[model samples]
Target: MPGFLSLRTKTTSIVALMVAVTMACGGVMIWNTYRVDRLIEGMVSDSVAAYQAAEALETALVNQKGFMSYYVMDRNPEWLQRLGEYRQLFRMRLERAQGFAGTAEERDTLASIGDAYDLYVAAKDKALGLYINGDEIAGGEAHAGVRDQFFKILDHCEAYKKAHEEELFAARQAVHARAEQLRWVTVAALVFVTGLGGVLTLMLGRQVLAPLRRLAREEAGELALMEPNEVKAVTHRIENLIRSAGEAHTELARSRENLLMAEKMVLVGKLAAGMAHSIRNPMTSVKMRLFSLNRSLPLTREQEEDFQVITREIGQVDTIVQNFLEFSRPPRLAMQLESPSTVVDRVLQLLSHRLRSYEVTVEVKREKPLPNVTCDPEQLKEAFVNFMENACKAMGGGGRIVITERVVSETDGAGLAEISFADTGCGIPEEELEQVFQPFFTTREDGTGLGLPISQRIIENHGGWIDVDSVQGKGTTFVVYLPMDSEEKK
Candidate 1:
């Protein structure tokens, strides 16, 4: 709970949890995959080898059985030679089968078959020897007796083969069972990952986006968003902000100054504007005096440190108070015949260098020059500048801004000039739509959150309004609608 409120800490915790869960799922899947593969390999290698060996034993026993009978019938030495070869082949096959036998039961079965074959072979060999010695009667009698033993050996071979078949079948069933188990594991992991992803998304929305949205609405100047560093959230009052008006923004600052210092000041306008101008001048003078004192005055180390703190505090107060006074002051617009499209061109020209630094591109789309409207050109410029700069800040880098100008006809036959500024940047959430034009709503860190409210006020003063439409991840569009001069309506 020490630094628990920090965004970095919360975000790190959320991301780390998601990563841990993902890695755990992945590890299980990988382990299960390896286990299945090993099972399949072992089943094939062990069961298949035993089955093939059993079949070979059967073939060798059958081959030996007929050769001994043939020797007795043909009364030829060639048949006896073949019978001996078959006997050797049977023995070799029996040994191989014994080696392949995976279980003690299988080994015992093979051993029984071996003993039966040995007895059968002994009798067949004796009969063949008698046949070779030309004792036809005795040889035939002995070979006849060997047939029962031979059949017994055949029976043992068949049983051994059958046992191997059953073992192979059992192995196959085991493989299937393992595969099915793998499927369930996979399904469970998928469900877990999906649920984890949902939780991470919710955490991000609650821990990150909600605070950021609130931060945009509040006028807190600096926030400790993370640690050891201060972040300045932008405060935008669109039509007038001179602090962002350095170098490329100089023209914009001058324009806003003109909009504010118009000659036709009256009533509350005169008083508020007079007060702002009065306070601003004295603050500037005080800042200059403090700077001179800081350099020229010499004192003890402790006194010097105290003086520096006071100076910095005063500077902060001056800046904050000036922004507040200007935010509260009534704007005095120098309204005249001005083409908004042309005003946009000047703002682009003025902010060209700044836009380039952000690697942002702006495109203007219009069928033709828009009809002229009565507006304060300076205020319009400042507002357009705010929109463009906000677009640049929204995208962070390398995005497009499209400005479309057109004329729309109202139901009362009056035409309104529509200027749309669309940006390819992270869009605002729909739930916070109402707050986009609130008094101090800005998306940038370096700007005062006064642009939107001031821009809204400036547009309203010209009998116009601003509309915002945004879709998450796609982009946002800000459309300004202003009444065209009656005579110049398209």
Candidate 2:
């Protein structure tokens, strides 16, 4: 059943994707239209540039030939060297004009231009050789025949240039007409594609997401009666729905577990109450009798000190019993606007004695003027104490601990206060990290293991998250991000 549903869903998704892609493709048509216009404009501009270069080269060739003719007619050696430079300029222009010719007619004109160019070069070379050989009179007579042939070649070059220009003009006009036609076609295609996309979006909205959303609601409504197998089946079919449903199931499981824990705590409280009643009277009598004996005894200083030690040990036992009684009873609501910095300071104060004895240093860095957060001050203190105590214990001997407070914004338009506690200690193993947050999970021999879990519950009740990151053999960092209330801001 899951496989069938998955296939159907995938098919629908693919169809919708194709529609979106086709719509995007249509958008490129307008760009194509503009590209065609540019092409036409470029063709005309390039052709004109080519024609101008050709015209300049032809004129330069004529000038160079005229100079060569004068040098030959007069048998002058001065103008010979300058002729080579002018010939180079003419070649450059001819090369440029060669690019503008496309069809057979244009090619034939270029071929004629090439023949004329060769004739000019041959006539100039012959004249220069004769002048160099010191046969001025003979060179002048030979130049007379070559000079007439040179003019005919120049005439042919000019005619070819005129014919090439006409062909380029006609080609430019045809290209412009084709470019306009392509532009209109592209525009029509673009409009049609855009309209197609809107239609596709409308179709998908009507066909896929709406029905899938309804199906999701239906599946959610039937979650409780679902067995593990049923859940697996649904997960295989609808992954997104499965994720949201998993959260709901998790919350339901937590509620059930908490109810069981509360029942167990009630039984423990009853036992604690009975046990206290049995021990309190005897402890009180002993404490009072010891107090009297200490004062009455006129003993040596060492003996008096021994007596004081006995009393102090008894008092410590009493304190432990009292703490147990308090733990059995639930705490009351004591929400207040308290500074996070003050909380960190108080926790540091509580750990001062141990900090000195263990040689552990605690550092606090806070953002200035932090907003107040509404929470039970005592619970917050307990959470911080539990975390700090755990961190200190993890360090084993001595380490640096850092605490910081800052505000952050979440994607949901809610502002949160983020508090971090980090310690340089032997970090938890990757396998053990997740279990560290569970009740009765501990790495220490004598740890109650309830400290972290209870602290987590307290924070969670106030709409906050407690996340842990640890690197084995490096350190651990615990982050608490809690949403802020309106009054807390000020």
Candidate 3:
């Protein structure tokens, strides 16, 4: 009862079963194709060809014999020439039959025929030579023996023809056997189809209509429910169930919200753990540089540079902490009218050294001048910086990032400043794209996984959204769409 399909799967299965039955019927017919019986066809063809060859051998023999008789009557060399023609014809046909002979016995038969043919030719030539020499009595006597040899050869040919005729009959019988087998196969297929159809009918009646009938009787028994449509009755039942489910859903809605809040807290806690671990590497550098500055107070230029590096690392640590807190309790954006391109330019300049360290290059493409957007430039810069950092991390060692800025006019009397960051790097997997903004999910060991989430929060806080598209091995493109101010839209 738990797994019983509620008409949707059951009905689909019935249709599929019908298709399978149709395919089975087609498969049965396919078995009846001539390709399946090619062996029988080849046998029949070879038998027919060998039989014709034997018949032709006898024909050529007959033609040769009558010509010798005519040559005896007139002593015409033309008759002997014609006789030679028929003899050659017999040899040619015999060779063709030898090629088509399908068995060892047939081969021996052809060989014997050839030997006998050779003897007949030799004897016939001797007799004809005598005739041409004008010794009629001796030539006639020799010719009589030649006729007996010709008869012997003709008998061999007739026997060979008879053997092939039997082969022809056997081939026909084989064809009949195959046809009968196919007929039985077709009968089985029909039986299966008939049985499957019956089963389908029974299932439809008992599984589908019977449930409707039972529901109808239970609901309105009197007068057999006034003969209402079964579908209408079932639909009415489903409607009631759906109404009850709606009520139940209303009861659970608040609890569902509480559960989602709890899930977010758990994710935040996970991100906190990852962030605490990630801050150490930068903080450690900050402490070491501070110790160096304390030892060498009036520091050399290089030491002063180290002090500056410590300051920047401390700032980075503060930014990370600030981003984490901002993600927990999202603050209001400081909306200011500024070109989105300016924010992009600042982020690139800020990240220029980091980009070089990662061996990544950035190419910015602007479509004229971008429209001013109502957004917190700093927050936008933070988001853009995260985007570049993510791209650098994805690139790992060496790659390129192309940042494109443009204005898009919307249908609802608004314009959008679209900043797209396209990275040539190892891309995000398709399955994990949905969770990219979820806290503490990362593809690398040192990743805090807070960067993209904080970036997404900042973008969404300013009434914008981010779209990420990636192919597995190719790369990723992150497009940020922020609506422009009313003045810009006008």
Candidate with the greatest TM-score versus the true structure: 3
Q: List the residue pairs that clash in candidate 2.
A: none
Clashes of each: 15, 0, 0
Cα-lDDT of candidate 2: 0.74
Writing each residue's lDDT as its tens digit, candidate 1 over 52-164 gives 88888788778765765665566567876776787788788888888888788888888888777778777877887798788889988998899988788888888888877
Candidate 3, run of 10 with poorest lDDT: 219-228
Where does candidate 1 have its weakest 10-residue lDDT segment?
Answer: 226-235
Question: What's model 2's lDDT at 180?
Answer: 77
Off by over 4 Å in 3: 1-210, 213-229, 232-319, 407-416, 484-487
Candidate 2's error at 52, in angstroms? 42
RMSD of each: 19.7, 12.7, 11.6
Q: Model 2 over residues 30-99: C-alpha lDDT tens digits?
A: 5656766676676567666666766876787777766666675685666766777787877777777777
- Of models 1 and 3, which has the larger lDDT? 3
TM-score of each predicted structure versus truth = 0.41, 0.46, 0.47
